[model samples]
Target: MARLQSSGFFDLGDGRLEYHFVGRQPAAAPTLVLLHEGLGSAMQWGALPETLARTTGCGVLAVSRQGYGASSPVSLPRPADYLEHEARAVLPRILDAAEVGSGVLIGHSDGASIAALALAEGEARLRGGVLIAPHFFVEEVTLSAIRRTRAAYERGLLRTRLGRWHADVEGAFRGWNDAWLDPGRRGWTIEAALTRLTVPVTLIQGTEDAYGTRAQIVAARRSCPPGLLTVRELPNVGHEPHREAFADTVAIIAAFVRRVLEDEGAGEPHRPDGAPMGE
Candidate 1:
């Protein structure tokens, strides 16, 4: 199994983001970079990082963006185009700071949307991506869920639960919730970005997700290049498939990572006897 190499703060000159690094990547192998959901942090990923490293035989790096976890805080009422800004600007810097030469982005929810944008806009050495519960456009179901979340936050239940992981729970909640629920941002959609992706992508969605619907997958299938995208729908699973269907999620991701590497002729890490390392 891959062991945890380090866990600490990563200084971005302007901010200090928390991060966890697992295992080690060889020169030819790709690193797995995990991006969390809107209200998630490096700690929120739980054991998925270590499991991915062990199953794929690749290094795993999970980082918390600014305004969440132990990272720096942001001003209130974020702009409607914040997600786009994150994709085109912040993500590239994170990759460069981590010194990731080649990578497969594994992102959940809001993170998934960011990954899609990065792939479309261009991130050198980005091999491919696995997007879980991504949102391409604003949906009424998403808004309804956010409203309920806001209610819970006002009652203090949600805040108490999220406070365990986030240093500034209010900032974490408002930064994501307020921006997404803005009426002026209702037309937000990344379909144009999806159309520009040149690398392979796997999109996973739960059938019972409260925040989105099958429309998301349909839009992705319609927009992405033919034969470049793969879709997986989990039966009876909720939004957090990584936690709800841990083994199945890991298996699917591991297979995709291996296939991408093989297609790129990057191959897999080998043992001393020349057999595949993760076999």
Candidate 2:
């Protein structure tokens, strides 16, 4: 593994957000912003971020959301407005503090939703985005899986493994699980909001993902500005494609980022059929 670095925290008003920076900084390469899943923390990513950073030559910023990892505990139930806050409120501050003028965003699951919302306004600094196992709409299977996960946490060995990553595994689990299962959140769909994003986006989903279906990809393809979007479905993979097929995930992302940057330096910023960046 590339030499790993110590993790730290950034005060974001409500709490201090935990994060880790990997790869050589102040390098002649684009920055790569990484957002973890609902139950993820900086440590949970393990060696993936470091490996990707070393290969891509991009400085990696991997972060745990407010209520997860070594960050502050969630004081209350997750707000229905959490995703919105992540986009409009939280992310800008993070980018500003990091001094990330422009780069790519790699978001998984809940992180994908957050990235979609955050990139809607199209910061000029943004190069592109890669979303893995993103969740825009809920599936019956997903809720069922979450229920199963809760049971496993209670009766199975889920706690033993998760405890190593999260300072308070219960806080992380309840913050995501409870908010998602809340009946009021059932109708939450971002198809309309996502349609407004102009950034070049690549959505990756597993063919076997039980939490989402082809309908989710179809919605994203139809909603996003045409041609600027790409979708890749990996066969025989599940919800956590990055974990199940790590090399493939990294390869696709690396290629997409390099291509976007190359196109930006050319005349147009997208394929002929797709809309330009920030359209």
* Candidate whose TM-score is highest: 1
Models, CA RMSD each: 2.7, 6.1
Query: Which runs of model 2 end up more than 4 angstroms from their true locations?
Result: 1-6, 26-28, 266-279
- Candidate 2's clash total is 2
lDDT of 1 by residue, 67-135 (tens): 999999988889888878888988888777777778999999999998999999877788899999999
* Per-model TM-score versus the true fold: 0.94, 0.90
Which residue pairs overlap in candidate 2's backbone? 102-125, 227-274
Q: Candidate 2: global Cα-lDDT?
A: 0.79
Model 2: per-residue lDDT, tens digit, 1-279? 223245778777778888898754523346688888888987787677777765565668887888889988886599997877877788778776666766788898898888887777677777778989887877777788888888988884988878888898888888888998988887888888777887789999999987778888998987898777899999999988888888999888877876877787722333222444334
